[model samples]
Target: MEWHNWSGSVSAQPRTIARPRNESELRAAILATPRVRVRGAGHSFMPLCETDGTLIDMSDYDAPIEIAADRASAWVPAGWSLARLTETLWKEGVSLINQGDVNPQSLAGATATGTHGTGKDLGSLSTQVIAFELMLADGSLVVCDAEHHPDLFQAQRLSLGLFGVATRIRINVLPAYYLEERVEARPLGEMAERWQELAAATRHFEFFVFPYADTVIFKSLHPIAGEDEMPHSTDIDERPFRVACELGRKANFLIPPLQRLMMRLSSKPSRRVGPAWQIFPGERTIRFEEMEYELPRADGIPTLLEAIGYIRRKKLPVAFPFEFRLVAGDDIWMSPFNRGVGSSISFHQYARMPWRALFAEIEPVLRGANGRPHWAKRHTLGPDQVHALYPKTGDFLKVRAEVDPAGKFVNADLARLFGIERK
Candidate 1:
């Protein structure tokens, strides 16, 4: 049998698959295999989950959420999907501090990859974690937190599953809140003209702009009194968009006109009020290979425009839109948004369209702007590039080595990126 990621861009044929039902079983499964790699929701676009030794699945490992006595945080099973975790937390009168637009990722997977939402003051999910319970390479369990194991905790915040296998995560939460979501179509020029005003207008703000199009789908979400109106239905047939992508795939030259037509038809005004969890994640069934970069906030607009200009000038048939937003920074050792307030730009292409070559052509534009790619997204950085972009790569590797000395979690791609020698 074969294991593949959401976009079918990465796959692995492991020697064995272990589905652990409990901690004892999980430990036994790990100790029984010479090498192990944990499995999450398989949402990563990169080869993070590719393994040849043994693949361990924890989706079946479920437990009740343990709220802190002060009600400031909760211990959640790392294997639970963000969709499940957020819904469950809402019922407990609490909510996650922030959430990404797509929510199928496991709690640990999101945190490890520095998954985030749009907010100038809100940091990524990794920053919300208070502690972690991990299973080491020797199958021994240990807990790490700011007070107990500072170095390990710092590294685990965004370790990309390198340091250890996270079994449970202590995450901060807030009193349940509601949000009013608004969407409108606007001219592309408006992005730069009112960048500061737009970012400050809402708690969550973002825009999606297809490379060949002149308009953008602007979206904003802010706290609301309650659900005063019906929420937007997520039940529209996506065939129209899919058909457009297919047309472009067959005849690349028709991309620009097709995109303009689609944008014109999609221009509409709509609003919805719903619980924060429900409003945070949008339905994302359309498959696309994505590459995301985090840059200094000042360089966002110019860099995005340059990249988009190149696509338009070259008549590139890129099929998906570029998502642009803001994310607060953190001190996490391996986080791309750790340096300072950052601007996040995500480049995507319809899964069926030609992508790698275009990504190769544009990755340099981002890198030249001092951008750092999301670990789980597409990027072709060698070890030196990785070390240069992340000054703490040595520190992260040090902790990774200390926890998993035998390199139990290192796979071929990871080995190449981290300069680790594989036996």
Candidate 2:
């Protein structure tokens, strides 16, 4: 079967591409393949579920979600993209308790990798999952929650779908509400002082600091008191299509130095206010490679500032601001943000630009802060380093061995990184 990824960055000729209409079909498909991997929207940058084996496309099973009246929780298909799910929940007088920057990811894809959004009060998307239905390697159905099969449930939340296929999820929700977003462009020093309060006060807050300049854009989302107004700003330069054009003009065919120069000049700040969905996820059509690490919240600003200093002194032409956001720690054994109050730090560079030099430059800061890289983003930490980052790494590996003893779910990449075959 032909192979293609959602990002189109990585693809291979898979043995087969299976579109299973239901659980039985899915199980049969998995059983047919010597090895299998699940594919959703393919939003991930890293090759989490990539394999030359059979690929399961969960996109065909989209259906209406059933939710409790309190807006507390609901069950949804693993195939549903965040955009459709959030919009549908709003129409039902409810909304997802948390969201990430991109809404194109499938529910299982996002939660499996611990994809998160910024909000001090809110946690990563996986934290809201009260229970999840898994189709094990043996083609057996299992319902995992805090009560039954708790260890499996905890490990499965952000395990990169290593144990089994996630068929459905029961998630926590919130009342459908509007957010009053505020964006400010200010000096970096000022942002450092207000960072803690900013994270604590706003429902969601994130800031981007451009290199070669002190200018930083800070965004905060708060609940609206009265009736919310319609979003008016359509002509913003930061819109996805325009940004894509800008990046194409700068980096597409040009040399790395030229791209750097363009980025240095293009660094600017802007603001917006609107609904939660509108404000939370922006149009990021411009494709750039990203590397993100989750550090303790207490060390967030310091780690960010240290990296900023390194870039400035080294004369690295970083076109974008250092992106920073927070997520409450979860109980997921494999989740990087499971420790508590995780602060995510992301580095962005044009795909054509050489990354080894830049990644080497930033690796020290992450190491010093005891950071853990996001599973779905770019990183080169080996299994030993990954084990050092998560206290429960051994336990998670044990669970994976028990659930998939034959290694039917394993790929070369996962096998090497996780040591699944040996354990």
Query: Candidate 1 — what's its lDDT?
Result: 0.88
Residue-level lDDT of model 1, residues 340-379, one tens digit each, is: 9999999999999878988988999999999999998999
**Clash number for candidate 1:** 0
List ranges where model 2 is wrong by over 4 Å.
1-8, 62-64, 232-274
**Decoy 2 TM-score against native:** 0.90
- Candidate 1: 10-residue stretch with minimal lDDT: 229-238
Reference-based lDDT, each prediction: 0.88, 0.76
lDDT of 2 by residue, 298-381 (tens): 898899889888876787644444688888877678888777887888887655555556777888778888888888887887
Best by TM-score: 1
**Model 1, 342: alpha-carbon shift in Å?**
0.5
Q: How far is candidate 2 from the true structure (C-alpha RMSD, Å)?
A: 3.4
Deviation of model 1 at 40, angstroms: 1.2
- TM-scores, one per candidate: 0.98, 0.90
What are the per-model C-alpha RMSD values against the true structure? Answer: 1.3, 3.4
